[model samples]
Target: MKTSSPNTLTEKLKSRVVLIALFVGSMWAVFFLSVALPFLHLNEHGVVPRSLDGLQGILFAPWLHASVGHIAANTSGLVVLGWLCTWPNIAGFWRATIGAMLGAGLCAWLFGAPYSVHIGASGLVFGYAGHLVARGYYTRNLVSILVALVVVSSYGLSLLFGVLPIYPDVSWQSHVGGVLGGVLAARAGAGAANRVRVR
Candidate 1:
């Protein structure tokens, strides 16, 4: 009988500063824009424009949002999903992060629609959701599967609605793009994480 003693990618942290820093930093920045400078409309400069003629849209768009509510929603999702996506395997963690940026940027480029300035890490959220689901199935890990299910259940109860033309003004294309980014990243990183476990 084979006993399953899988290698742990990351044991609980010696200090929570790194994670807390990321979490708090994300929240703080978002809140600053939402509450502090929202009246000033400080984010007009960083919308995810349909065209990436300048790198500003690609680089800074995700950080800016249309409204305080928009930033707040994305911030909340980030606080929870950001940690979950990166907390496990070190390899997968980095993969997801890079992949998410790549995915969001790609989505912003491809399906941004005309004059449809997009922004926020929702694309990255979709990217993480895609990563969790794909990683779970590929690795045959129950945790990944449960995570995928939870993502589907909570984050996207109306996954198809997000994909289809159910809601106007919302870019489902970015969501799809993020999913593609996540799949690519998870596929690449899964093997690497598994390899580390076996070694």
Candidate 2:
């Protein structure tokens, strides 16, 4: 493992601050819609909402939410996972996002039934969860293991309830799908991290 550069902590911490700002900015924009935008529910539809139609289909869903509570929960999760995965670089950040997208998109297409609408960053969260666990296993990194432990012990594992049909609107398909994507991302990230260190 690489040793931390004490002098670089300032730069790394500054980058982390920027990441926090971005996270807040995104939430603020979405929250604004949920509040000021009376019809915000229009975009709440999963991944461009089948209603929107066309290339817009590619945009991520869960960037919107049904209510303040919804966005609040996702915001918290993103901050926690975002910080954990992207310690001193944007590579992990984008990697996790792509992983989430891949996980959510595939699961929505494969497991999600046609005509059904799925939304929420829960899929992304699951992906982050899977990525953290797998990354830790692949690299034998302490931080990754610690983050995964915290995620499983706290939010990710207990939320299996949300994945079940106990609630009519929950999209377990997205949840499960995101997790699968995260696993793939973790494998890729481990290899990438290793390559970077060697050269």
Candidate 3:
């Protein structure tokens, strides 16, 4: 990969920080509006399994939450892991997010219990975690490996529980799909980055 000068790298890092902040801020803003505008009934926009109408939820579900608590639980993880996903750059982050949203939404739509709605950013959070961990194994980069280690150490145990069906209300299917999507993102991204370096 072409090395960036110190000034350029610093500027890039600053931009990344801004990007993450704006993304998370938007989520919070949406949540606040959902609260302020009860007539909007934004929660109804979440993914409803096995219904044709639910298909649109794939685009909106990640931004909707059942309650303030639901969004609150998702906020910290989304901010931290979301920022990590962007470390390689915004394009990779967008790829990971879109991939996870589609994968997780499709999984829930296909296998989730009928007449159920799934909302929250947990799936995307899982995707970010999975991407961070898998990128190390795929790329064999020291920085990626170190990042993987940190992610594993911080959230590995929770991830195991999150993917299981032990919690009746939780969407384990989304978790599974998120993991697959994240690994796929890591593979594609690492390959692309390596090719760039080779050229």
Candidate 4:
């Protein structure tokens, strides 16, 4: 039940465009650099469950991908869902992102299989989707709700499958954690986008 004026909305949109650019651009940059410098073994930096060293991955894992294809698969969701998250405000986007990152990494570290190193932006993608969907329900905003419906219609089935343990190669734990994080963000920022008077 919050509304933003045309000018405020425009500014928010513009800010989000820049935020997304920096986001995707950073991902691409890291991927290219990792490819260029194979010896860096960037993939090794991902979260490894129960390992003290893996804790750092909580902050770095989302920026690292297993391969070009992996990052490509997450690119669309990151852009689209990320955009929707920012539609409310850049602060909300950051809140969701940080929460998801921590949630996914922590869960993967704690619950993932031993000797496994989980990596990729998929957790963040799931987080973005979760935030948008849950934000609608929590805030009861028509636009947010519509965006949620559209997301559910477009990627609901796939999202459902991603969280299943059937996929050996995927870290379903991360997916679950990411979603929980998004929901947490929505709850934390419930009043972040409340209706405001336009001057």
lDDT of 3 at 167: 92
RMSD in Å for model 4: 3.2
Give the alpha carbon lDDT tens digit for every residue of 56-77 in model 4.
8898999999888999999999
Q: Cα deviation of 13 in candidate 1 (Å)? A: 4.5
TM-score versus the correct structure, for each prediction: 0.76, 0.81, 0.93, 0.91
lDDT of each: 0.66, 0.69, 0.87, 0.89
Looking at model 4, the pairs that clash are none
Residue 97, candidate 1: Cα error in Å is 2.2
- Residue-by-residue lDDT tens digits, candidate 2, 11-81: 78888879867865775686686678776554544653234441132244756566777777777777777
* Model 1 lDDT per residue over 33-98, tens place: 666756775455444555555246555656666666776666656656666776464456567767
Q: How many backbone clashes does candidate 1 have?
A: 0
lDDT of 3 at 184: 89
Q: Residue 52, candidate 2: how far off, in angstroms?
A: 9.6
- TM-score between model 1 and native: 0.76
